[model samples]
Target: MVGTAARVTVAACIAFYLCRYGLDAAVMALYATFTVVALGVLARIPGSGRQRAVTTLWVLPAGTALVVLGTLLAVRTWAAVLGMLVIGFLVAYAGSAGPRIAGAAPGMQLLYILPCFPPYAPGTLDQRVYGFVLGAVLLAAAQVLILPEPVTPPFRALLADAAEAAAALADHHDGPAPERTLARARTAADRLRPSRVPPADLPASPTRAHKAMAHAAETVRTLLAQLAALHGAAAPRGGYHAETVGLLDGIAAALRQAARALRAGRRPGAEPSVAALQAGLDPVRTRRAVAALERLGVDDRLVFLRRRALVVQAADSAVVLVLATRLLLGDRGVGADRAGHAFAYARTPAWVLWWRRLSTHFTPRSVIFQNACRFALGLAAARAVAGVLDLSHGFWVLLATLTLTRTTSLETRWVVRQALIGTLIGAAAAGVLLALVEERTTVYALVLPVVMLAAFTLGPLRGPAWAQGGFTLVVATLFAQVAPVTWQLAPTRFADVLTGSVIGLACGLLAWPRGAGSELRRSMAGVCTAVADAVGRTASRVVEPSAGPADGAGIVALNRALVLAEESLAQYQSEPREETARQPDWPAVLAAGAHARRGERLLPGRPGRIGDGPVGGWLRREAGRTAEGYRALAERLRTGGPDGPRGAPTDPDAPQLLNIHGLLEVVPPPPPDTDTDRAAAAALLVDAVVWLDTLTADLRRIHGEMAEMARRAEPPGPRLA
Candidate 1:
């Protein structure tokens, strides 16, 4: 904060002195300093010095175009009004897809207002541009050189925290469930998104450590859950092998290395091996455990070991990939193969792909396209009003309208309230300062540094409303130096802001009406469907690993869906209560996703295709049924119907599941040599059946909870309010 304040103060004062010395173009330079500081400290993107410099360079050309267009339109009253309306709509529409685009909208609107200032001397335009470039460079340099903070620290901390949580899960420490621990990890990871450059890949970006961290955390959580479930459902009645305990310790050791690597931002050193544990499984003991479990018609420990091994393998692979991202070709080391496969279709002919993307926007379902039109319409209306009033600086009205509107009505209303209140407070403060001092220019110069310093400090401390107030005061003071400062100026500015706010609010509520609550529900439903699809696919893999290893695409889709759902939920929670929206059990939904992912990781690329007859058949059938259950749940979420499993829930330990128990515990067992491989395969088949059955039951329960959520009609209390 101190660095930012100092930089802003230095930049603004320099610009002011240049302007006082007859470089009249320094006015824009002053604004540029504010822009650079604001984007550096407040905005999410263009975070690094290089990225910010690039973004600023791009903004110059783009902003210049808007100014030229505005100047052309402003010559004729009708053209100016019409242009404002159109420009307003386009900027608003462009941002309907997400917050990043929405954030850029204000800057676009500011460009439109830039040309509305009094005409400059011939060649003074170049001077202003030069001033802007100079200020931007100085500001960027300050951020890069002054007590620079490392970009990786916060991200490293997030990964380290998640790894510790995973280790705790493996140790069966008493605390939150693995699902809850992972969710917190994911939440933290989200905040760790890289501030500077755009993410290099979709779903999971190899260049983004946070993405890898979040995914690894989920994998660990799932592994722990599988262990817990197997322990609960299949209590091996005999003495446990010390090897099993050692295997768990090995997995825990790998997790510790993962945490250390993430903290150090380097590749992991040689990790503990599970090979010793694998060797310790005496065939005689394994045979007895399998036989005893089969006799009891329960899950087998050997089967659990096989499944656990798969998860450990996946988790270790993920951690290694994250650590390797810093090396040469690091992004491609472990995880890049999957990422490449996911985006291989992008290699299609560029023209064809571009055409398809463009065509998508023309469809009726394209909310972004429709939003753009609505924004234009709203701006037009606001411009017409401003034109009729013919107030001093009528463009301010259009600026307000453009700045106030957001993706949702609720958000627009909130912004309007803040902008209006802020403008009033700022105008009053500026008016007082102008009136109090006998030496206006001297007081203005003295106060400029204080205001610039305060703007940086107060904007973050207070919310957007207070920030807006500071912004208004700065603008009023700057303009007063170039033009006349009068008490009437404050009221006139207030009227302009009021007019724009009303127009923005009206457009938000009435045009193509979509509330945050509705968007939230829709996003949540999408997440449910995504989870269902992953569960179904995983069930297939468990039933028939020989078909192929579980694809990474399913988990990727799950992650993307969850991110969208979380974003929509945040927007919804920030608004007033609405009818037909209920508090969703997000944790339950998240847990279901975790289960699906775990199930996927549990399957091997190659399972024994030749298995014992009846046991294998039953396993396949159970897996199919589990897939069907997940599909049903997905359909229910999409359609919002109550059709779920019609009959009572089946017992996980029922007679059907115990069928393998009878086969293994026969009074006269088959020849020991012949039954060795067959017995192991049969035991694994039984475990698969139990796991699928249990997963399906959990899916059904989540489906029921979602159904109940759908039925909620009354408005709930507003958490954000």
Candidate 2:
């Protein structure tokens, strides 16, 4: 905050001085000063100095375009209002592309708002553009040359650290102290959870590399869970099976190599390919071990089979991590492979990716779309009200609306109340200052920078009230320097802010007032449904390879649903809510979706296939039951019912949905045969069992968490009861 304040103060003061004194241009000076505040304080572009400089440079052209558009539209009130509506929506919606765009969105809106007011000044367009360009250039330079912000660890480095942690956990899966190892593994996994990761560090872009990185993070979490499960499983008397040990060692090495590759920025074509590591730890060995256990007629055959299944599941997760990492490193070969369907955009053109990102949020169901609409309508209404009322400093109305409006009506109300109080206090102080100064331009000039320094430095550190109050004082001193001002200016400023707040509050109530909280539930349900469809489709393909190539549609749907759910969760976390509000365990819900998608991706890619037989028929039935379970879970989420089981079944021995452990215990193994087909079928069945088990565990965890939250949300029963 200190660094940003210092840089903004230096750049803005310099720009203001150059335009005011050197050029004697009041319009240019005003624009130049506000430009610095808009870009520096309002739009907080995150990253190192160089990254922010580059981002600022990119934003300049957009800023210039908005200024030109605003100046042109200022010819009439209706034109400016319409322009505000369209431009506001576009700028806010563009944030769906990436963090950089999202960070610059507020500044872009301010650029348009500044010129689209009563001045009707196409004649001053040149001055506005010049001042904007100057301020932007100066700010960009200041970002790099003036007390640059300290660089934080990069997101890729975080991912690398997670991979290294997972590697360590894998290496000691059978350590003497299982509890300690499991705790460490869980902690490492939690670090990669979306809720735990910083928003600035999230790879949420639609580009291939970002998507791949996100998938790799989720896969690492899955791998850690598998390893933790292995650690907790009762070890055989002679220790882990030879195949399990080999696979664990192989997985550990592969993870270490991945971490090194990430840290070194190695390309996908680098030596010792992660994909090849899968071949070295072949599932064939796992199948042979299962066969040997069955042949020996060991009393602990079922336990050994379960252990082998876990090892296979771990190997599957490792393969996904390998593929995702490869894609992140720009491996087009992986995109061309059959498994690339999971990452369809890995090789897509940039323009197409942008289009997809925008189009995906075009629906009313999307929180981004809802936010854009709310923002646009609020700003448009504020502009229209200011023009109709012929309010002085009309842009202040727009600015108030821009800053005060939040996703939820409840939050907007809270902010509006604080802002109003602050504006009132600031107005009174400004009125006193104006009365005392009485046309002393020098006093105003001297105090301007000090006030600016204090305001910019403390506003954000404080709350919206501080920001509103400090900003009110800033505009007062600024306008006093530009021209003559009286005590009346304070009241005018407060009145404009009040008008904007009213408009913003009205829009908030009329639009999606509940914010992502409600949408998050719907999105989670959508994700569950998509996962169920994908799981059923993948199981079908596994049961019958000739069921045609795996339909990419289900994968795409699941990906889209997961993306939307994640975005909603992010917004929901930011919005204000009552303490007693009933909310699902969002992180757990997200994990369940990720697990389902990962299972779908891994099912068809396993080493073997299953033909229609007793085993295949049983697998199909189990898949149907799993799909039904997810569908039921989705229904429960939507209906706001308890996420956990409602009550014990009338028949305790009846087969339960997602009870893979019980099902596997009773499932008949493939008939004894020396042929490879039987062995392949047995291996495929094991993969299905493990995948189902993992998914079931995730669902149960989500259920338990949700049930707890629901219980907490319930009010105390009547004393009479």
TM-score of every candidate relative to the true structure: 0.68, 0.91
Each prediction's Cα RMSD? Answer: 8.1, 3.6
For residues 1-721, could you state the per-residue lDDT of candidate 2 as single tens digits?
Answer: 8789889988998999899878999999988988899999999787778778888889888999998999999999999999999999999999998887899899889999999986787889999999999999999999999999767666677777777777776776453335666676777677777667655667878777887888888788877877777777777676766666777788888888888878877785663255555675555445654564364345332455555566666666676677778778878677655456566667677787667777888889899999999999999999998899898789999999999999999999999999999899999999999999979988988898888888888888888888899999989998998899999999999999999999999999999888887687778888888878877887888888777575455666777888788888888777767653555566676666776777666667655667776657777777787777678778767776322233311232232544334445545554555656656666666667656665666666666665565555557887983
Worst 10 residues of 1 by lDDT: 197-206
Give the TM-score comparing model 1 with the true structure, all chains together.
Answer: 0.68
lDDT of 1 by residue, 272-367 (tens): 222333343234333543544444434432354344333333333333323332221123233333223322222334454344334434433345
TM-score of 2: 0.91
The local distance difference test score of each candidate is: 0.52, 0.78
Error of 2 at 478 (Å): 0.9
Candidate 2 collision pairs: none
